[model samples]
Target: MTETAPATATPGTPTDPGTGSIAGPSVAYQNWIDRQSRNRRQVQVGRALILIAFLALWEVAPRAGLVNPMLTSYPSAVWEGFLELLAQGNLGLHIGVTLLEVMISFAVAMILGTVVAICLWLSPMLEKILDPFLVVGNALPKIALVPIFYIWLGPQGSIYAVAIAVALFITILMLYTGFSQTDPNKIKLARTLGAGKRQILTKVVLPGNVHTFMATLKANVGLSLVGVIVGEFQASKAGLGYLIVYGSQIFRMDMVMAAIVILSLMSVAIYLAVQKAETWLIR
Candidate 1:
């Protein structure tokens, strides 16, 4: 009887018929994927444990006399204050006002910064003329401008003004720097193809610096929030910042902590929103 030779497997065909996986690479790849997933789970667990430990320590320290309860209000007191604020129907208003101011400031700064950066990129002479002034503006103490803005724009207007002022200059600087750093070779290639400045900017410069824009947005979000809070500390009638200031003045440590916790959560939400936007833009 003639013996038939075993059929040879083609490229990408499973070498081991029982396992149905590519020979060497399949095992290695699966191992890598498993390791990565395990690592991620471990990291998440570690973070959760750290947070729990911190909360437990915070809850224990004051009650155990390691820290003063009045000065460093515990988690329970802060939670009660938060619940009370929520029940009073003012928390929502404060959150809404602060969110509105922050969004307005963030939008205005981003729009203005983009416009200014584009103009600067278009005109080297204009950029040179404005460079010193830009530097001075960035270096100037923003806190010093708070009272001036209050005088010029009144209380509510000053909040927007301060928030914009805080984010705008830095946004301009970061964006302009990113714009200027576009590869000269790419620009020359575009020029060789008879592409105009506008085309080059839209097609090459902007696309190349998407990550830079994301970074700028991340920073601007925080700066805008800070500006709003600073303005509220001095001028506004209601906001988490006003809450903090009022609570501190009244020695309501629980209220102050509650406001701070809310602010922290707001910051996280804004940052995550920006990150989600970046992901969408990238895709």
Candidate 2:
């Protein structure tokens, strides 16, 4: 009868004493996870500290007469202006109006642009015919057309028109490019399997371009907001943009700062929402 030797741990390979099971890799993995967690917490702390330092400097600079308070209101004054607006009960209304306009423009641009991109992709002749016109239109300074939109569509309609104009062209261009770039080998395989163009598009192309769609959505958020603000600057009676122009005209720098702060926060929230949606889609 032959005797069996007991399994032993080697260098870099720890073993459970009783069962002789390998445990080193699991411990190393746990250590890596801990390090990653620490790194993320440190990054978050660093960001908070930087923001605090900036706010402190801003608050101190004007008080010390390093800069004119009238021209550059501090954080406290902006907060006060925000409170005053809230008390006036119009702050909510302005925010709501701006948000509604942004959402409408975003939805319209995304839907219309995606359909246009698909149609262009489906017909190479149509794409070729429209290519030069699309390029020219996209290159045209959209800001130059603001007054024309206002004249043609009036105040509310002009807001939507301007917002869509800002976002639609880029969306179509990006989606068409992404669709055209779908792996040729995959398309060839689909065709060889007797798939029609529509099936190839729905099964292979659309699913593959989800990340592109998310990218377009993110870009459209900022562009649509910019267009709405620019339109409101010219044609709006009420909105954050209107408030900004009104405040500047009245030389109420604090009020202007407050509106700008709100706009920044709003944009951040919308961008974060889009990021979260992307994460969900990828999962």
Candidate 3:
């Protein structure tokens, strides 16, 4: 008799005819994972190349004396400056102050803006009345108002004012857009089902516009940071902006560059955090 292969089976398990084992992933699945890994690696390589190019230029121009080292400094000098700031703990303090301003302003703006948007959404008459005011506020140069804020609320007041200025218009615009763009068919369907206005807003409109709200939040993160930095430029005793001004005033180009780098890094960090939160919220 010819030898016969015994069919192997596991209780509660199925086998693939080609692989003989159920534990292995299909080729399509493996290909998808490989493609994703390759894409991730490419992104990483691209980021690394950009950073290396920036640093290389910073190192080359100064060392080659093509630029005035005192005026522009070198990448090494800025790195050393960063180390000094880290050792002294001033960097942390400065960053903390700016973060506090951003958080407070953002929170206040979001709450107030949402309330206003909701009220307007509920009452067309109120929206009509407030439209001009909103338009004028949005048109005004918020930076110019910093001086008035300093005078009225004192120097620290600029911090709150700037944050509000940055966040308010964006929040209002986004929320209004979200509320206005809600699907009319959904509204009609909800009404036909005997849903109240409040129910329509709470159960239908709000959820429908969650994605838009998340996008606005991401945009607000950048705006809030800009507001904080602008406030620092106007009147803060300490912040990344203050550090830049101080360094430049003293002709410490390396310190100025370091502070600029810190500000850029902070912005990136805030942006990334917002993006992560948006992803979670949307999912």
Candidate 4:
């Protein structure tokens, strides 16, 4: 007898028997995936084009005498200024110092802020008592309090205090709001199943607020950087903020612009790190 082929398993999708081709949901889903991929690529290409155009204009405008290079330094001058700092070893030292302070303050702010938020969630009375203070702390111009922190913690240590100050209240308010806004029906359901307060929080409230936690962390990361820079402005002698202040004072516009560019890069890097962590946590 002629050999017969073994039967192959067919996928669940409806198939065109004549062509042996998927002709149902699988085809639609594949098309949707392809469409999304094309859209993402287009977005990336558009963003790159816009950025290149902006940088090209910025670099050209100053050198062509269109914009005052002295007041607004060109990209080449900013690059040269970076090289100057690099040759002097100031670039890495100052960056490391600022990074250290930012990391420390960020950790402290997130921890303490989250704990306080949890406490407020657990006790409505405590939340009401502290609500005004939280709002006031968030609203008050943080720079004005730098002096008090400086005096209390001295010049070098003040950066940590200021960093914590800038991030703490905002984190607390955002997280507490997230916690309070957690679906009450879930909490009630958990309790009806004999879950205790702590169980409800762990199982219902905390899990429900992961996105909020990530959002608040993103906000605090920037705030912590701002605080560190401000603290450097008021106290530190060798950080990027100090460099900016010193450069501006002596009219070394290139150095000031370089410092600013470096700060922007640092903030972007930190924010990217947060985004990466968010993606991992979400996964």
Top of the candidates by TM-score: 1
For model 1, the local distance difference test gives: 0.92
* Candidate 1: segments with Cα more than 4 A from true spot: 1-25
lDDT tens readout by residue for model 3, 13-32: 67778887675555566676
C-alpha lDDT values of all predictions: 0.92, 0.92, 0.85, 0.90
- Lowest summed lDDT over 10 consecutive residues: which window, candidate 2? 1-10
Q: How close to the true structure is residue 10 of candidate 4, measured as C-alpha lDDT?
A: 53
Candidate 2 or 3, higher TM-score? Answer: 2
TM-score for each predicted model, relative to the true structure: 0.91, 0.90, 0.87, 0.90
Count of backbone collisions in candidate 3: 0
User: Per-residue lDDT tens digits of candidate 4, residues 1-283?
Assistant: 5333333435865678999886655455566667778879999999999989988998999889999888888788888998999999768999999999999999999999999999999999999998999999999988999999889999988888889999999999999999999999999999999999999889999999999999998998899999999999999988899999999888888899999999999999999999999999999
Residue 129 of candidate 2: its Cα lDDT?
98
Candidate 2 Cα deviation (angstroms), residue 147: 0.5
Question: What's the residue-level lDDT of 234 in candidate 2?
Answer: 86
Local accuracy of candidate 1 as per-residue lDDT tens digits, 1-283 = 5333343444856676778765555555566667778879999999999999999999999999999999999999999999999999999999999999999999999999999999999999999999999999888879899999999999999999989999999999999999999999999999999999999999999999999999999999899999999999999889999999999999999999999999999999999999999999999
**Cα lDDT tens digits for candidate 2, 1-283:** 4333333345657677989876554555566667778879999999999999999999999999999998999999999999999999999999999999999999999999999999998999999999998888778878888899999999989999999999999999999999999999999999999999999999999999999999999999999999899999989999999999999999888899999999989989999999999999999
Q: State in Å the error of residue 70, model 1.
A: 1.5
**Error at 29, model 2, angstroms:** 0.9
By lDDT, the candidates rank as 1, 2, 4, 3
Off by over 4 Å in 3: 1-25
